[model samples]
Target: MARIGVLLMAYGTPRSLEDVEAYYTHIRGGRPPSPERVAELQERYRRIGGRSPLFEITLRQAQALEARLARLALGHSFRIRVGMKHSPPFIDEAVAGLLEEGIERLVAIALAPHYSRMSVGAYHAAVREALARRSAALPVAEIRGWGSHPLFVIAVAERLKEALEDLPRQETMVIFTAHSLPARLREEGDPYETELLDSARRVARVLGLDHWRFAYQSASATGEPWLGPDLLEVLEAIARQGEARHVVVCPIGFLADHLEILYDLDVEAREAAEGWGLSFRRTRSLNDDPLLIETLMALVSEALAD
Candidate 1:
């Protein structure tokens, strides 16, 4: 049987405080951030237990998916590898490793569920560039997005339901959030915003939630308007309404616990909500959740079938 390579790609995080500058520079397209910016980011990491567990969580996810695939006993065996967009074990390195292992075919999926030309599109582009660099002709399949996949919706809904158990359903406001992108993408006809809202809508429908609102979070300060209403702004508005006493945040865009979830939502947004006299709680991340693994398996199977 032929062996299939599954490449899981994600936006990488720095391994340590010392690596933050380089990681930021890579994300900035080789332009180093201001010293103040670097310090601010390092501080955020410091507050979040000195490092982001995103890399480890992503590795665990890969391991779990590979094991699950083995149990499926699909005709072809599988090898799962992780690649980072802006860090070591990069896309090119993973592609080369897969070639070295003599895998007969490849399937790549970004950890992100929603597709944006700047996000999932970039991952696919990296894979193509890597193959070109090696002049290796390999059969490749790329999953652009799976936000609305049934299992994915269930996984997120499951987490949201769990979080809602402690709050008064009618009195608590649910805010669905994702990372913000530059507003310019909308002008260019990007489907990113549409896909994100659709996923949020599906999850809301699953829970029969009528009070949930979608917002964007963790937008970089590039002196330009990103997606909105921002999560913090939304919280303020909810506070003014005096309708809900508690707020439950569901970050459908992120799949793991990282700075965005740990600091941005847990610390920043929580504090903002508290300041406005509104209780705040965020749904737990879906890192290595069995349902998420199943969702990944389904995506791979569908890709291979095509």
Candidate 2:
């Protein structure tokens, strides 16, 4: 049986505070961030325990997926490698490594569930560029978006339901969120917002949620309008309405625990909610969750079959 290469891509994180500037520069397209901006990001990482666990969690996900595939005996052996966008062991490096392994075919999937021209699209573009540069002609499959995948919806819904178990559903407002992108993407006919909303709606329906809302979070400070209503603003509005006593946030876009979830939602949003006399709780991230691993396996299978 031929071995298939699986490339799992994610938005990377710096290994430590010292690496923040380099990581930030990479994300900014080689333009370094201001010292103040770098310090601010470093502080966020400090608050979240010195660094992000994103890299480690991603590796564990890969390991689990590989093991699962082996157990299934799916007619072909699978070798899974993780690639990060803004950090080391970059997409290109992963591609080169996989090619060196002499795999017969390739399958790529991003950790993000929602598809945005600026996000998942970029990952696919990177893969294509890498292959082009290497002159590799192996059959490749890229799983674009799986936001509404049945297993994915069920996993998110399960997490949301667990979060709501302690809160009074009647008084709790379920807020589903995703990383905000530039608002211009909408004008360009990007389905980023639509996919997020569709996934949120599916999970809400599964949980029979009556007071659910969708919001965007972690928008960059790029001085341009991004998606809205933002998460903090939504919290303020809900608090002002005096209708809901509690807010449960489900970050459906991200698949792992990282700066955005740890700092943006947990620290910043939680502070805002508490100041408004409302209890705040976010659904636990799907970091290496069994269901999430299953979802990845399913995506790889579908991509291979395609």
Displacement of residue 44 (Cα, Å) in model 2 is 0.6
Give the Cα-based TM-score of candidate 2 against the true structure: 0.99
TM-score of each: 0.99, 0.99
Clashes of each: 0, 0
lDDT of each: 0.95, 0.93
What lDDT tens digits, residue by residue, belong to model 2 across residues 20-39? 99999999999999999999
lDDT of 1 by residue, 159-193 (tens): 99999987778899999999999999999999999
Off by over 4 Å in 1: none
Q: Give, for candidate 2, the lowest lDDT window spanning 10 residues.
A: 297-306
Give me the candidate number with maximum lDDT.
1
**Candidate 1 worst ten-residue window by lDDT:** 165-174
